[model samples]
Target: MNKKQKKMLIRIAITAVMLIALAFLPLTGIWRLLAYVAAYLVIGYDILRKAGIGIIHGRAFDECFLMAIATLGAFFLAVWTKSGDYVEGISVMLFYQIGELFQSYAVGKSRRNISALMDIRPDYANIEKDGKLEQVDPDEVAVGSIIVVQPGEKVPLDGVVVSGNSTLNTSALTGESLPRDVAEGNEIISGCINMSGVLKIRTTKAFGESTVSKILDLVENASSRKSRSEAFISRFARIYTPAVCIGAVLLGVAVPLLRMAFGADAQWVDWVYRALTFLVVSCPCALVISIPLSFFAGIGGASKEGILIKGSNYLEALAATKVVVFDKTGTLTQGVFEVTAVHHNELDADKVLEYAALAECASSHPISKSLQKAYGKPIDRSRVTNVEEISGHGITATVDGHSVAAGNAKLMKKLGIEYHDCHCVGTIIHMAVDGAYAGHIVISDIVKPHSAEAIARLKKSGVSKTVMLTGDARRVAEQVAGELGVDEVRSELLPGDKVAEVEKLLAEKSPKTNLAFVGDGINDAPVLTRADIGIAMGAMGSDAAIEAADVVLMDDDPLQIAKAIRISRKCIGIVRQNIVFSLIVKFACLALTAAGITNMWAAIFADVGVMILAVLNAIRALRVHNL
Candidate 1:
């Protein structure tokens, strides 16, 4: 417990002991009243003070005002009747304080959970000066400067490893417990801990633009964007509190006057006591506190699992998503292209690939990179001469004093050379050596290991439709779609066409459901903004996509998409349950109290008991690991 909660606990204990002792003693009227008043002031002084301040500030229609009025009215009724029964008023305030203390403790526990998730903030960066290492603020390091990260130190900035190799612990950033291995020339992000060896890094971004900083900014501002349910509760409490207060006054005066008009005894004391009971039963504390707490705990829990939801509003929307749209490259498939086959070669397969890799060595295209990767050897550019790059076709060069050509079918047709067309679902690169038809190599992007399973999980989680949007060829797109079990496929689309497709899907779906678009490229930014919810892969995704997205998957796993939806559905379910349960109990108690069927003790349960149960249910949103 925090210091304030500790103090409140002490006060509650003292008040309970005093009330019990006064009940046992045989004191007379004045002494008994003074003892109960002393106990009431000890437990409820702050509540009375806050009610007085609200009245002075013209905001008297709050829970504090209701509580203060009810307890004070009960005390006045007891003294006027000379009943010496002050226990009812003191017990009401005592139980209310107990509920407030429980709320404080719950909120504190949630803050601690969020604080643990935010422990990735680095304290310092190690920079070399005068042949010695000096620790400085991470903000002071400039881009392109070299920073040293020793064993068990956090990488303070986004950079590329210039020297040494190490195993990095990325649990704080990705929520995965496995350590990632890094070597020279590998790109490393901030907020990862170096677990094995010393690493020298060349900084690529400053501290403010690092991944840790952006995530922290998103989490800190999440509460400002409230969900629809929270806003409704706020409006309801504003109107509900004052209306109940007025009803209590009418019951106190109107009922007694009606009795006097009927030529019966007024029984003013009995009627006024029922009014006080009604006020106590009608306080809206349960609905006001539990709804927002559920959302806050849900966000905190999701952060621990590497899902960064920008706001509670987005979380609510994600739970209602029935349509999921995906971008093919870097989302459902590994974006890197690889050489899959070599056929129809006059020389050896390795020989054809070597010539092609050498011919395309001067270019930096993705296809050329794939050929070079397949070659698995360093190229000597001096061996090639008379190089010519044919536009819309291929490259022609002399490799080791032999004519070498590498292109597609159009290039062979232009050269008047007969070539065999291979039937394959990939990008085909035909090769020609010395004006003779050589083998063609096939390059294709491999699908991710978990992409198909992710689609299945989404379907099981209540998603009705799944679509894949791609700028790739129709053949390749359809092949991937078939493998992934997507319900729809839109192929050979530009960025603008993707937006149009999303708009069409938006119009086609039911109005009550939502559509989410997922992508990981710079061109996907516009479509990401156009969809109902934008999910971006943060690890290798472009900066523009992340900026426009509503949800970010830190580990770039498609499986997290389903898990996020499940977490949100659980949270909204708890919110609805609390709203229904609190309202049912509150209205039921109000009816019994006004009819004089229950007393102040029952009103205490109607307010404090229900609030305590609702708060306990809200805390369940913080446990989401198994989900």
Candidate 2:
């Protein structure tokens, strides 16, 4: 409990003891009045003071007003007896204080829950210095410093492997209830636990610049951005509180006068009691507090799982998404290239590889990198010269007096080199020696293991269709789309072609159906921005991609797409439940209160009862993962 909560609990205990003593003692007149004063001072002095301040500020109608009227009425009731019903006055204040304590306790519990989620933010990082571990503030730790992370410790900074390896339990940040494997060259985000092994991670980003830091910053500010449901409750409370107070005042003055004017014997005291009870039931404090609390818990829960939803507006849009479009490379397939096969004529495969490496050394295409990697040999660089690039085609470079051309079939066709043995699944880069057929290297990218599951999960989340768009040829695109269970495939697209395809999908969207686009790192920035919800895959390493996408999956696992949709569905469901529950109960209680059928005491039950139920429901947002 916080300092404020501890103090409230202390006061509650004192009031409870006083109540017990008052019930047992048989004191007379002023002695009994002094007891009532003690009990009221212990429990409700602050409330009385608040009422007085509200009166001075010209905002005197609220819960404080209700408490003041109820307690003071009981004091006047004490005048009927020897003690002015001082015991009843104190007891009512005591019960009201008990309810306040319960609310404070609940608020403290919810704050603790969220604070536990934010535990991912570490206080310091251990920078390796001359083989000794030195502790420093995360912000003070410079980039390129090697931070040592041991088991059960959070990765305090974002970094790459300098040495050692481990499995990271990222439940605190990514909400994936699984531990991830990390090794040399693997990148790690801040806030994940080093479940095992001692890691010497070379920090790629400073503390404030890390993924966890940015996420913490986003979540900390989420409450300031209100959802539609929260806004409604705020406006309702504003109008409802003052209106109910006005009704209560008119009831106290007009109803007794009406009876007296009609020559009836209606007492002012009895009508005043009813008016005080009406004021107690009209606070509207509960709805105002819990509505925003629900969304706060929801977004906090999502942040715990490594999904950064920019705002609640995105959460709402994500819940309504019906069509999900995906970028082929990086988004679905492992964006890394590998040599799947080698086809060569008039030379052995090794000789073909050696020559291709020399020619491609002058270029920096992904396929060239794969070729150089496959060759497993270093390029002399001196053997290569006069490198020239062909737009959308290939590169021409002279190596050891031999003219080498490396590009797609476009260059092969343009050079009039006849090679018809090209396969459909992998990228085929043709090579020409002085404009003649030399050989071709086939590079294929493997699909991510999570892509298929991600697709299946999206289908479960009410997504009607999954589409893949890529700049790769139709054959490669078809091969990937088939493996990943994509419903539609648009391939052989340039950057413009991808944009046009997104426009087409937008046109096809229904009034009720929303469309989402997922993409490779930052290259699909334009398309990611165009979709209803732009989810960027592999959010951990690329700051550019993370900024462009509305929702970022820190680990770049496509399966998180489904998880995000599921979270949105759950959050939106909870939001709807609260709204429906509040409105139905509020309308019924208000009707019964306005009608003379239900008494003022019953009105208190209806108002306070509904507030308690709504608050309990709002707390469900914190436990969303269990749901």
Candidate 3:
């Protein structure tokens, strides 16, 4: 508990003891009233102060004002009637403070859950200077500077490992318990702890642009984006508070006047007591506090699982997702092309690949990189000369004095060489050496192990449709879509084409449901922005995609998509449950209080009891690990 909560606890204890002692004492009249007033001031002075401030500021329609008015009126009625029954007013304030303390503790719990992520912020970066290690603020480290990460130190910036290898504890970043292994040439992100070995890294991004910085920014600003439900509650409270206050005043005056007109006793004390009871029961504290707390707990719970929801609004929308559109590469698939097969080799397979890798060595395309990776050897670029790259075709270069042409069938047809087409479910590269058909290499992107299960889970989680959008060939796209169990596939699409497809899906779906687009490429940013919710693969995703996305999966696992949806649905379910429960109990209590069927003690339960239950229910949004 915080200092404020501890102090409130002490005040509540003192007030309770005083009430208990006063109940036993045979005190009378002015002495009894003075004792009760002293207890009230001890427990509720802040509330009275707040009400006074609200009235001064021209905003006197809040719960504190309602509470102040109800208790003060109860005390005044007791004195006017000479009943010496001030216990009712003091108990009302006492129980209200108890409810407030529970709320403070619950809010503190939610904040702690999110603050766990804040521990990832690094204190310093280890930069080598003058043959010694110098610790400096991460912001002071420039891109391209070499930094040393010793054992048990966080990688302070996004960079590439230039020397040494280590096991990284990535739980803070990805929430996965397993440690990740990194070696030379591997890209390492910030906020991962080096667990085993020392590593020298060449910084690729400054501190502000690093992954940790972006995630911190996302978390800190999350609460500012309120859900529609929260906005509605805000508007409702603004109108509801003042309207109830007016109704209380009318009940206190109009009911008594009606009795006098009927030639019966006015019974002003009885009618005014009912009015005070009405105000207490209609305070709206349960609805005002629990709804936002539910969303806050939901966001905190999701962050614990490496799902970064940008706002409560996005969390609310995720619960209603009907269509989940996915970009194939780097989303559902590995996005890293690998040589799956080499066939129809006129020359040796290794020799054909060698010439192809050498010819395409100068190109930086993914396919070219795959070829080079398949070669499994360093390229001696000096041996290759007279290189030419054909747009939409391939590359031509002289390797070891032999003319090598490597590309698709279009390249072969354009070169007038007879090439044999291979029936393969992948991207095939036809190779020609010395103007002769040598062979072809097949490269294919592997699908993620969890992609199919992710789709299945989405369906089980109430998602009606799943679609895969990709710029890959129709054959490849169809194969991947089939493997992943997607309900629809839009293949061979450009970046703009993706937007049109999502728009079409948006029009086709019901207005009540939302469509989410998931992608990890720079080109995916536009479509990500156009969709109802954008989910990005943060591990290897382009910065543009992450920045444009509303939800980011730090581990880049497709299964997290389903998990995120489940978390949101559970949270929103709790929110609706709290709203319905609080309203039902509140209105029931209000009707009974106005009819004089319930007393001020019952009014305390109607106000504080309902709020405590709603807050307890709101805290359930934090327990999402099972979901």
Candidate 4:
């Protein structure tokens, strides 16, 4: 337990001992009253002090004030009636303190899950200095500086591996159990564990701008952005507290006076006791605590599932999303090109593939890799020379003493080589060898395994429309859209055009519905920011994409979108249930107290009993695995 909880436990223990001692004592009159008062003060001194301070500050309508008024009035009634038994008053305060402690414990447990993120902050960074490793504060490490991450050490900053290889334990960041293998040229994010090997990393971002810092900032500031339900509860508490206090006063004073004027022997003490009971029942602790707790638990649960919701407001907004828009490249497709087919070859298909691979051997483009993979043989670099890369076209190089040009239709037109369009749906790389038309190879990106399933799940989850916007050609985009079964497709869109498309959809969508856009590129940042809910691919997405997104899918799984929405909906449902149930029960108990149909015991049930039940319901938000 924390120091605060320890202190509360000590107070509870002392109060319990004193109450037991008072029960065993044979004292009478003022002495017995003093012993009961001592027990009450031991447990409730803080509540009394807070009530006084609140009254002095003109904020006297909170639970502390109600509790203080109710318990002290009970004690006063006992003394004025010449009854020395103040046990009922002391029991009320003691039970109330016990309830408050229970609430503190519940909230602390919910917060502990989110607080696990604190372990991600690295204490030090190892930087290379003059061929020796020097440990420095993470804040002191500069961008572009080389940092060495040892085995079992946390990656202190986001960077690319310059040397060495290792399997990274990304469970803390991604919530995935499988360790990720990384070699030279792989980019690694901060907060992951370097599991097995020593890695020499060239830092790409400083400590403040790193992924870990951004995530921490997001989680810390999330509570300040309240959901609509939480806002309503705050407004309700402010107006409800003061209004109930006034009602209680009128019930105590005005009702008895008016009854006396009517010639009825209405007991003032009885009316005062009823008013105290009303005050206790009117306390709004259940709604005040549980609403925010439910949302907090939902966000914590989402984080554990590798979905980062930036705020409770966004978590609530996610539940209203009826239209989900997607970017084609990196979002739905694998974004890795592979050779699909070859046609119109004058020579053997192997010879044409060999020629293209040789011409593009020195290049690092996806298309080049596809060609080299199809060739299935290493190129003799000595046989190739005089390589020239034509921007937006392709390349020209000398392969085995023959001049070979591999490019698009534009490149063939530039070379004056008459070439036939492949009429294929995939990207066609046209080729010419020794000024003769050769075969073309078809390359295309593979759709993600979960893309179709995710779209179907979103539809099942009540998403009204699924749309895709892409910079790819119409044929390619349409093929992907058809395969994924999206409702609409907008192709050949630039980054600015994507933002416009999202805005257009935003305007055209139902007024009650929200538009969510998912993308994983730096160019998609603007659109991500423009959408109502921006979801980013956390694992392979760019820093800009992650920064602008409101929701992040840590493993880059599209299905998590539906899971996130379900979690939010469940949390909001719980909030509404708590609000309606608590208010109804409280109002009913308040009416009963005013009519003399209920007493202090029922008042305790209305206040503390409802709060306990609401807290239990709020804890259900953490159970998101089944959802």
Candidate 4 all-Cα RMSD:
2.1
lDDT of predicted model 4: 0.88
CA displacement after TM-score superposition, residue 82 of candidate 3 (Å): 1.7
3 or 4, greater by lDDT: 3
- Could you give candidate 1's per-residue lDDT for residues 133-236 as a string of tens digits? 99999999999999999999998999999999999998887778989999999999888899999999999988998877777888888898899999999999
Listed in order, each prediction's TM-score against the native is 0.96, 0.86, 0.96, 0.95
The lDDT ranking, best first, is: 3, 1, 4, 2
lDDT for 90 (candidate 3): 92
The candidate 4 region of ten consecutive residues with least summed lDDT is: 537-546
Cα lDDT over the full model 3: 0.92
For all candidates in order, the CA lDDT equals 0.91, 0.78, 0.92, 0.88
Model 4, range 111-133, lDDT digits (tens) per residue? Answer: 88887766788889998889899
Segments in model 4 whose C-alpha atoms lie over 4 Å from true places: 128-134, 344-346, 361-365, 372-382, 388-392, 413-420, 539-541
Q: Judged by lDDT against the true structure, how good is candidate 2?
A: 0.78
| Count of backbone clashes, every candidate in sequence | 0, 8, 0, 0
Cα lDDT tens digits, model 2, 507-539, are 988977678999864788888888888998876
RMSD of each candidate? 1.8, 3.8, 1.9, 2.1
